[model samples]
Target: MRIVADTGRCVGAGQCVLTAPDIFDQDEDEGTVVLRTAQVSGDALERVRQAVHICPSQALSLCED
Candidate 1:
């Protein structure tokens, strides 16, 4: 799977970062959701899915690649 982050839709809620620090992070300057990587699998995929669902601004999503 692949992660897709809509940075413009992010509100700096930090939910994604908290949910999956390995896959997501907050930019220091903007505090927006910064994707650590686009591809995900194994244990990381689960956390990424949770992050996408919990993102307050609906800024995160996943797609099959």
Candidate 2:
């Protein structure tokens, strides 16, 4: 699985950060979503998916490869 964030759509609400801090981060200056990992553990994948769902701007997506 891979994670992708549409930088153009990110408003940096930090929902992804709250859901998966290991994989997502907030940019201090821009307040935007920062993807720390393209691939995550199987256990972490579900949480990442939840993060994608909770993003108010829908900037996050989980791609199964």
C-alpha lDDT of all candidate models, in order: 0.90, 0.90
Best by TM-score: 1
lDDT of 2 by residue, 1-65 (tens): 88989989998899999998999999999999988888976789889989988999999887777
lDDT of 1 by residue, 1-65 (tens): 99989989999999998888988888999999888889999999999988888888999889998
Off by over 4 Å in 1: none
Indicate which candidate wins on lDDT: 1
Over 4 Å off, model 2: none
As a TM-score, model 1 comes out at: 0.95
Clashes of 2: 0
State TM-scores per candidate: 0.95, 0.93
